[model samples]
Target: MEELGISLSFSRPRVSNDNAFAESIFSSIFSVREWVDQFIAWYNTEHRHSGIKYVTPNQRHFGLADDICEIRRSTYEEAKRKHPKRWSRHIKSWQQPEIVKINHPRPIKSVEA
Candidate 1:
């Protein structure tokens, strides 16, 4: 690798959750180029990512995240109310986050006297 001026760094073993979704997409039936295009389309327009409150990335991009989240919240609330015993706690949060962080850095605390 060094001879080709390339460096390879591997993430820790058994810690591949971050790459699981990509792996699943790439392992689909489509060919490489076709899969890339298809994956992009699906990811942006169709796929509802849990990390983003189950809305498509395009929805968030177009500023429709809040509206969609509200709808989801209402749906869940109604369902829970209709079947109260089906839920043991409050309805799941469908709130759209103002910011999304990947591998977010930990904040450092300041020491006071």
Candidate 2:
């Protein structure tokens, strides 16, 4: 694995988020080998991922991510302004995440003994 530039880290059982995403894709109605190409197209161009502020992967790849996120932010702001009482504090943020991690470990806190 090291020769191939792959790092192997042990993860807890059934705790991989990437595995869940892959499982969802594989468990679809279409056959895996036959429909993988089409699925990839749809996943990249059509699917809006919540992890990326609901922008499709294609948009991010083509540098349209900022424009799309700006539109979403404007829409949210307008809605919040229209119904100020409906909101408790602030409107939902439409900003794109600065970082995306898969199966990243949680920070450990040390207890002073």
Give per-model TM-scores. Answer: 0.58, 0.60
- What TM-score would you give candidate 1 relative to the actual structure? 0.58
> Which residue pairs collide in model 1, if any?
none
CA RMSD of all predictions: 14.9, 16.7
lDDT of 1 by residue, 4-29 (tens): 86544365444537576767887774
lDDT per residue as tens, model 2, 12-78: 4334463665668777745766588888999999999888888888998788988988988898899
Write down the lDDT that model 2 would get. 0.79
Q: State which candidate has the highest TM-score.
A: 2
- Which window of ten consecutive residues has the lowest lDDT sum in model 1? 7-16
Question: Cα lDDT of all candidates, in order?
Answer: 0.83, 0.79
Spell out the clash pairs found in candidate 2: none
